[model samples]
Target: MTGLLIGAIIISFSSVMVRLANVPPDVAGFYRLFVGGLGMGLFLWRMGKLKHFTLHIWAWALLSALFFVGDFFYWHRAIGLVGPGMATMLANFQVIVLAVVSVLILRERPTAAFMLAIPMALAGLYLMVGVSWADFTPDYRVGVVYGLLTALFYALYLLSLKFSLSKAGADPLAMACAVALLTGVLLGGLSLGQGESFAIPDVRSLLALATLALICHAVGWFLITRSVQMVRTSLVGLILLLQPTLSFVWDILFFDKPVNGLEIAGVILALVGIYLGSLKGKRGK
Candidate 1:
């Protein structure tokens, strides 16, 4: 639980790090995955487990990487447009998306609490932006769309990753490393196609990107993956919420994001809904 808490805190700084790097979205995504993947590969090599991945694992990792490419592309753009707080919060709409997918495709029945959470979350979003959405600029509207797209892609990534982990003898670390490296390659190609530079601008930007790669992607994810299974599922859901919550706080503190009373209420309501949506109810005997 401590590890989970610490991991969440570490990841909460990811948005700020991206902003500090101030690079093109694809550039930031490429470095984050490439550097983080290298770190994980080194760790696995040290443990004598780097060469053990099966072809099946590699295939699944490739699929997961595709989804993650979409995830980072939209998410980073949203962060640049909407400010980190709202962007992070909007991306977390993945919980709701996952819930809906479980119900529709997996043929699972949602709990009463989960059913109730859906409308509450929508209401929260309405409060956050729908009230004066037309008054906002087109770029801001596009950012919101990108944020929602991030949620969709993130949900797909989670589903693919879950399936990958279910394979026999699948090492989570190795799978993560594969996905990160592959995604980095894809993002790098995309960056080049878009004419984005690969060079780091300054020492501060370099440090920020490096910390984002090693700390948030490598250390933070490792901690969460290691500690999550040991904790209660419900508790894990709640604890993981800290990432988005702290991200919102960091945006306000670091970027001085403008907020109103309605927006605060919306954030609270949305978070509560996300938490409720993440919980699994007991099956009947």
Candidate 2:
């Protein structure tokens, strides 16, 4: 649990690091995945755990990579349009998306908590974006849409990853490494096609990107992955909320994001809904 808390705090710095990098979104994502993937691969190889991957695992990893590409593409843009706090908060909407997907595709019954959470989340979004859509700038509105899309793609990525881990002899860390490498490759090609340079502009940018990859992606996730197994699912959901909550706080502290009372209330409401949505609920009455 301590590890999970620490990991969440570490990952909370992700948006700030991206802002500090001062590069194109795809470029930031590419470095994050490519550099992080290499590190994970090296570590696994050193541990003699980097065994051969089955075809099924590779296919799932590829699918997860594609979904993650979509996630980063929109999320990074949203971060640019909105501030990091709002954008990160919006992306955490994945919990709501996942609940909806479970009911619609998995034929799972929605828990009472989930049913209530949907409206709470929507209302929170309405408050966050304002009652009048026309009152906001076009960029802000577009960023909101992009943030929701991030949630969708992120949920898809999680689903694909879950399927990948369900396969026989599936190593969780190995799957993560494969997905990261594949995602990096895809993002690299996409970045080239978009004519974005891979160059790091300065020492500061390099340091920021390196920390994002090594510390946030590699170390943070390693801790969370290992610790989550020991934590209760409900508690894990609440604990992981620290990431976005602290992200919002950092946005205000570091980036000076102007927050009104309504926005603050909205964030609180949305976070509560997300936590409720994450609950799996009891089965068999």
Candidate 3:
């Protein structure tokens, strides 16, 4: 619960960081991976377990990094295509993707309440976007596709990262450091291939992006790692349900965005859906 709460708070700052960042989305993605990796390095140095992590762990970390870094790139691009509110929610639709994956991989089914509320949540989200779409240009559909893909990849990232973290054992500091290095290397290569500029960010964007790397990415990843250690993956999904909610609230508070009647309905519906999903875990606990 502590870890989940921390993750929620960390993620709450993410879009605000992106909104304030004037850098290209691809460049921002690069910094997130690399700079976040730097934070992990600092953690490992302080803990003195740096040498225990191996190349094999790095392989998994790099794989996880690729999925996430790729998601960030597309997700940020999606924000440009669509508005931040819907894009953030849509991209976080990863939790639903995780549910589908669990059905296939873990042989689990959602409870009745969850099933009943999912479509409502989705419908509320769709209604939110449909209104946005109605007002926005038609070309923005490209972002919707990107957002969908980000969710898929993020779900897989959640699964794989946890598996690797478990395999790496309780040395989260070590795991974080190794993965950060691996992730940074991958994102660096990606930035190079994309021909993104190496131009230093202005003071405002740089400060914001650095804070994002520390709080939103580094601290957020650390907290989520702790959550994976403490809870079952099933409830991990439920805990992650906080992210979109946080994202929505952050947009309203910091971005000076207003939610419409239906958008509020969507929020209520999603909360109900998440509540239903959480009931199974609560009963077990």
Candidate 4:
């Protein structure tokens, strides 16, 4: 439980760091993953587990990394366009996307709880964005679209990671390193293609990106994975609810973003819906 809270708190800073970097989303994502992969690679090598990456694990890890890159790319864009809180909350829709994918590909039937959650989640979204349609700008709509795209790509990442884990054999460390390295390379290439400068313009940007990589990516994720092994699955799911909620708070506190009553209600409804959907997924399994 402590690990989960720590992880969530650390991850809550991800958007804050990205925003502070003041770089293109692709560039920020690239540097964050690259630095993170470098540090993780060194740690794993020092632990004598660097050579454990088998062909099978590498194959799936590469595939997983591709989706991960897409996830982060759109996620960062969403954050820049809409603000961290809305973007983070929108990205949680990946659970719904995953449920749909399972129904189509895995032939898993959706439970009644999931069916009910569908409307609840949509209602929350309507309250979050659709209510602002009278004053919505093109950029705002684009951000919302990117947020959904982030969720889609994130669902793909989750599915690919699951496959990679099954094929990773005994060396989870190696698999993780391979995925991170590949994701970094892919995002780096993307940044170059977009003609974004990779050089940090100032020390402040450098510090933010470094913190994003080391603390948010490496430390936070490590804690989340460790907690998963120690805590009950249901509790873990519930604890994860804190991440987006705290992200919202961070945006308000750090960025001076204003919140409305409707937005607060939307957050509550979205969380309730997500909880129900996840519970149904567990029961279905």
Candidate 5:
């Protein structure tokens, strides 16, 4: 759980890193996966099972990458469009969406806590982006729509990951490798789709981007899997709920972004909802 918390915070810093890297979004995202994949491969080597890994598991990896590609673009675009607070909530909305799938398809009954968390999460989202929606009117709706698409795709990505990982069987590190490789390929394709040519990053940005790819995607996903294996899925969701809060905190710490009362309240609501979402019921998944 503690690992998850640290990982979440690291993950939260992603947007800042993305912006700081000062590269085109697709290019930055592609490098992120490539770096992350390389890190995971190195980690797998350290585990002494690198020789045993093969193409067989790559199908899962590619599927994982597909979801990630959708998620990466959406999330990247989202932070730019909706602002971090609401974008984080919407991006994290995958938790609730995943929970519903678990209940309906996997027969993981909905906990009362999950039920309570829904409204809290919605209220948090409302507080985060409600008034802003009014400002859109007819002029900025495309951006709003793009943001909504981001949230939806993000949720799908989470579900695809959790489901595929649980069904596909492998250590978290190995899964990380598969995911990294897959994400790299897919992101590479996306970059090409956007007419982006791959090239070496600047010395400073490369170093910074390398750290983020290693920490956020590599260690972050690894720790999240560890936490889920150790804790209840619902609780795991709660632990990750800190992601948006951490994102907000990162902005304050690094960019000197101010947190007004309303923003603070929105964050609090999101946190509370996360708590409720994490709660275990008498009949829980």
Candidate 6:
């Protein structure tokens, strides 16, 4: 529980940091993942655990990396368009997307609680974008679409991670390193192709990027990876609710983001929706 809380808190700053880095979204993802992969590599080397992975594990981890990179790419774009707070919440709609996909592909049944949660979550998502539907301009609409794509890609990452972890018996750190390395290389190429600079803009931006790489990507996710093994998957899902919740708070506090009552209500509603949706797995257990 402590690990999850701390991890969520650390990662809640990810969007804010990316926005502050003042780089193109893809460049931000590249630097963050590349640095993180290096850090993990160093750690594993020190522990004498750094070694080649089996081809089967490498295959799954590489596939997962594509989805992971996609999530970062779309999420950063969403943050630029919709603002960090809304984008974070919107990206987190992965819970719902994952649930629906599970029902379709994995033949999982939706419980009554999950069915009840769907409308509430959707309505909350509506209220979250803006108080009135009119507030969603054509540009912001694009952001919303990006946000949904972020969720979809993240869902794919999660599912693929599950397969790699379970079927391949992949070591978590090995998988993380692989994903980070692969994603970094892929995004770095994308950034270069788009004329994004590899140079850090300034000291503060470098610090922000370093914080993202070491703290959020390495330490935060390491804790989450460890805790997930120690805790129930359903409970982990519930605890991860902190990421978006605290992200909203960070926006208001650090960025001085304005909000209306409807937005507050939407946050509450979404929280409730996520909790209800997550309950399905818990009850099944």
All models: lDDT?
0.90, 0.88, 0.70, 0.83, 0.69, 0.83
lDDT by residue for model 4 over 1-285, one digit each (tens)?
898889988988888899999889988888778787777777677778766766777787898899999899999999999999889999988877777776667877777777887789889888888898778789988999999899899889989888778866646556767888889899999989988888898999989999999988777876776577688756776888787888889999999988899988988888777766665353245
Tell how far residue 106 is off in model 4, in angstroms: 2.3
Mind giving the per-residue lDDT tens digits that candidate 1 earns over 150-241? 99999999999988788635888889888999999999999999999999999999999999999999888878887898999889999999
Task: Look at candidate 5 and give me any clashing residue pairs.
Answer: none
Per-residue error (Å), model 4, residue 171: 3.6
- Whichever of 2 and 6 has more lDDT, that candidate is 2
Alpha-carbon deviation at 167 in model 1, angstroms: 3.8
Residue 23's lDDT within candidate 6 is 87
Stronger candidate by lDDT (1 vs 3): 1
**Model 5 C-alpha lDDT per residue in residues 161-273, reported as the tens digit of each score:** 66666767656577667777777777778788888767646777876677668888777766765566777766676667678777777667776765567657866886787
Across 1-285, the per-residue lDDT of candidate 2 in tens digits comes to: 999999999999988898899999999999999898888777678778767566776787897899999998998899899878888999999999998888777777778998888999988988888665788799999999999999999999999889768863578878888898899889889899999999999999999999999998888887887789899999999999998899999999999998888888889899999999998754432
**Candidate 6, 157-242: lDDT as tens digits:** 98888787787787887788888888998899999899988888999899999998999888888777767678776788788888
User: Which structure among the candidates has the greatest TM-score?
Assistant: 1
For model 2, which pairs clash? none
TM-scores vs. true structure, each candidate: 0.96, 0.95, 0.84, 0.93, 0.84, 0.93
How well does candidate 6 score on lDDT at residue 72?
93
Q: What is the Cα-based lDDT of residue 241 in candidate 1?
A: 94
Error of 1 at 265 (Å): 0.5
Off by over 4 Å in 2: 52-56, 282-285
- Winner on TM-score between 1 and 3 is 1
